[model samples]
Target: MVSAGLYWLLSLAFLWGGFVQMGYPGMAGEVCIAFVICLFLLRFILVKRFVAASVFNVAATVVFFIFIAILQAKGMTGVA
Candidate 1:
C-alpha cells in the first residue's frame, strides 16, 4: 500500500531527473534502470536485515555519478 505510493513517487522523480540528464543517453538510461532495479532488490530483502537498503543507496549514488561521467564524456556541459 504505502510502498506502492512510494514507488510511484520515486519513479516520477527518476523520470524527471532522467529527462534532465538526457545528454548522455546510455548513462542516463542505465542510472534510471538501476534505480528501478534497486527498488525491487530492496523489496526482495526487506526487514530481515538492513544490508539491502545500504547496498541500494550506495549503488544508486554510484550510478548517478557514473551518469555524470558519461555526460562529461559526451561534452554536454550545457545540457544540464
Candidate 2:
C-alpha cells in the first residue's frame, strides 16, 4: 500500500507541476513518464486486478490538466 501511495502522490505532483508550468515542454514529458510509472507501479503494488486505480489516476490527471489550462487561458486573456 505504501508503494501505491507513493505512486499516486508522485503522479499527482508531476501533473500539478506540468499544468502549472505548461510553457516547459520538458516538464510535460516528465509528467508523461510519471504517469506511465504510476500505471506500472500501481499494477505491481496493488495487484493486477487494480487496473481501475491506474485508469482513474490517468483520468484525473488529464482532467486537472485541462482545468488548469482553461484557467490559465482566461487569466492570460484578462491580463492582455
Evaluate all candidate structures by whole-model CA lDDT and list the values in order: 0.58, 0.54
TM-score of 2: 0.35
How many collisions per candidate?
A: 0, 0
| TM-score of each prediction | 0.40, 0.35
Candidate 1 regions exceeding 4 Å error are: 1-14, 20-51
Candidate number achieving the greatest TM-score relative to the actual structure = 1
Local accuracy of candidate 2 as per-residue lDDT tens digits, 1-80: 44445556766665555456555533454544455566556556765565566565565556546744765665531221
Best by lDDT: 1
Q: Which portions of model 2 miss their true places by more than 4 Å?
A: 24-80
Error of 1 at 9 (Å): 11
Clashes of 1: 0
